[model samples]
Target: MTTWHCLSVKPEELRLDTTLNCGQSFRWVNTGDNQWTSVLSGRIITLRQTDDDILYRTPDDNVGHVEEVLRDYFQLDVDLGELYKQWRTDANFEKKAGRFMGIRILRQDPVENLFTFICTSNNNIQRITTMVNKLCQHYGTEIGTIYEVSKPFYTFPTVARLAHEDVENELRQLGFGYRAKYISQTARYIMEHHDETWLRGLRNLPYEECREELLKLAGVGPKVADCVCLMSMDKPGAIPVDTHVWQIAKRDYKLSGLASKTLTQKNYLVIGDRFRTIFGTHAGWAHSVLFTADLRQFEHRLISSEETKSNVVLEGTKREVSQARRPKKTAGVTVFDRYPRRKRQILEGKHGIVEKK
Candidate 1:
């Protein structure tokens, strides 16, 4: 076991539970006990959080500069608390974002971010995660397994590896669907015409120029290009307005007088510009907090006062009643029982109510 080192960050400033799984980067696995494990760069890292610190460890002691890596990956230098204060000035943001603190934009590798998001076009988080894992397992360099979990992790594949002739067919076989061609063509284009440095060099360009360059890639549309721009290429103002965001704009922001109901190319740009206007320079970062609030999987986090009282009752019951004899149904249906099994587990875990089995 490696020595666990502490990174001092308030839970309000950075919540691992919310930020890691909030549809930004898809590789993190919730391995129970509030610890998330994933392969970042080439290192297998495990992280757990406390009230005032984030504890991180690697498989061994030789992983030099792990702290720096964590700081960069989590973008810890940016003051999220200050941003939250600023965003709260907007009534909509203040209303929705009360529980959704500590959400930060990850500074991902441009290469990895580009290809992984290529797989994300019109895809859900679960499927996108599966495709990205498959890509890494097949082509990426084998990083070692986690200590007790025994599951091996791999680095995101290099451009050369993903650029091979057989990669597209292999990806299709691995259930990449139509995204196989995009990944293959994008990889080959980069490998042939540009190097990883050139791709990363876009970080130095203005947001529009950076986005324009990304749009030249095979799989990159406006949304994908903007995703890369904001997430990887250091453009915090670039908002990728998908259907969810379009609804957010129309419903919450009351954006109207548009020509079409559908999110046209023109409307997409309009919505992004509107958000940038509302949230200022780090509008994309502010957009992520609201976006996470709207996700179904995270609805359990938004606990109400009534629910909290119910949870208190449930806790009291759990203590008074024996584990085996405890009533499965509290009142009509217990709070935990209302959610799906997976979300129930998450809620139960959060409330410190252990499952019977």
Candidate 2:
């Protein structure tokens, strides 16, 4: 039987259905009765919210400080109330806040965010979720299972694991399509030429520099890099403009030239800067909420019916790529496979951290 640890939280502060499945992180699966389960940072964790608190569960007995883990992962420290207040200053934000209230950006592992967003290129949420799950099932260590799906849960695969495995062809066979090569090459480059330190170090750099460095990887581009920046790294100002957001820029913000269709590199920057001007330092979070609401409202009208949300797509950015075959195996641990200790200081940023009494 799975053991659960409970953490008290205000009901008004968050809604699990909106936050978890809003198309940010893909691992968590909704089992039933509002409960969600996933293998995060190598441990199989499950959670659900009641009227007064959030309940977290895990099959592993040694999982320490579950409350702290939830705090960090959900970023409960960041004040959504204050953010909503700030965002409501804009008329459009005020109108949409009620419908999408309580949506929060997850603080996911940077490595996972990088690959996940890379897989996001020209893809939809369902396929992206499937690809990520496949990476975990094929290469990640098995953790446990949830009732919603028959397959046992597995941790997200690490760079070393994907780098060493015959991942490209395997991923192609698994229906990753063209993204299989991008995932394979990105993993190989990380394992061969860099380390986790290099990737995490990008966090400390300026957003522009970090985006540039990330673009050097096989399939990473402006949208993917900015996603890793805003979602994982501490830069909340990073606005990842995709087709949905682009339509928003035109329809809502009335940013001209976007109506002709397609996100050019120039228009991408213009839209991003316009959002920063409107939402201030935390434009990325604002973008997330707006995009979430936009996506929910405009589900059928999206560029591709399969398209979910997140990141940008430059019209002239696609380039030809050499095909990668399966490579020989080696032994090592991946960053995603190893769970690290939680940080003591949560980023309170605009609002002070609040704990349930």
Candidate 3:
């Protein structure tokens, strides 16, 4: 017999730290009310309006235990009281700066994580989720049961499974942009190196050395590597600086002088090193909290600007700030619903594959 427990919190019980994994939403199967089960993690996680924190069982067939491994990984045993006190009193820390964005670190499988973060470079949450879902349906195992929905879905594919498959063209057909190539390359790389576990051994090496190992991978750039380091490898404060982070650090943190003419590979190391010095060991975690909050603020402002609002307008020359700030749209768009379209030459005959032109 095995014992399992889930120390759950409504909002607080769940630490919204993206350090567990990158911010890819492991969508919950709405098994009735508020309870959520990650088929990947195989844990039924939930929050409550009650006094005690929530609890969940570790996924069955797991090598050991998922939640227990997670607890130690997150250092849930440590008391944050002293740290919170330090944060509160430090004026330079900027306590009243913004609301903390609630992010849950999803317990994704190791291989899924490798490929998922690889796809995350120069991408957004919505697009990443769509791509992951598409990959799962195309390559992953058919579990043969729809828990929450009327239709069916499946788990993510293993590296061994998807390596030889040409999933990229399919992704292109589905509008994945250039990410199709990255996914294809990463899968192939994994397939080529079946016994490669050298990455996991980099834990004790110097930060630069560890980061370099990550860079050796096809799609693992600075940000993606940093995300993997922090989330997958238990590195506390590996700040993954992207375009949004570059903007926020300059505009909000007054780090404009720190800005470089290029976002080159070297610059990523320099900038990340500087922040680690500034924020101490947990700087990476701090970056996560602050970055999320800052992004939410930007999102809110954009939304508010789009919505109806009434304010006094200046007389002669003043234009609405929102109007001036709006993004430019692509010109000249057309749609042909029932029009005669270009046709592919079909030779539907014996031993039929599409014939080479």
Query: After superposition on all CA atoms, what RMSD does each candidate show versus the true structure?
Result: 8.9, 14.5, 17.3
Better of 1 and 2 by lDDT: 1
Model 3 TM-score (2 dp): 0.66
The ten-residue window of minimal lDDT in model 1 covers 312-321
The models' CA-based lDDT, in order, is 0.79, 0.73, 0.52
Question: What is candidate 2's lDDT per residue for 215-248, written digit by digit as tens?
Answer: 8988888888888888888788998978888888
| Residue-by-residue lDDT tens digits, candidate 3, 199-248 | 45566676667777778777787788777776666566677887766765
Task: For model 2, name the residue pairs that clash.
Answer: none
Q: In candidate 3, which residue pairs get closer than 3 Å at backbone N, Cα or C atoms, i.e. clash? A: 6-55, 6-56, 8-54, 9-13, 237-284
Q: Using lDDT as the measure, which candidate wins?
A: 1
Model 1: per-residue lDDT, tens digit, 204-241? 99998999999999989999999899899999999998
What ranking of all candidate models by lDDT puts the best one first? 1, 2, 3
List clash counts for every candidate, in order. Answer: 0, 0, 5
Q: TM-scores of all models?
A: 0.85, 0.80, 0.66
Compute the lDDT of residue 144 as modeled in candidate 3. Answer: 44
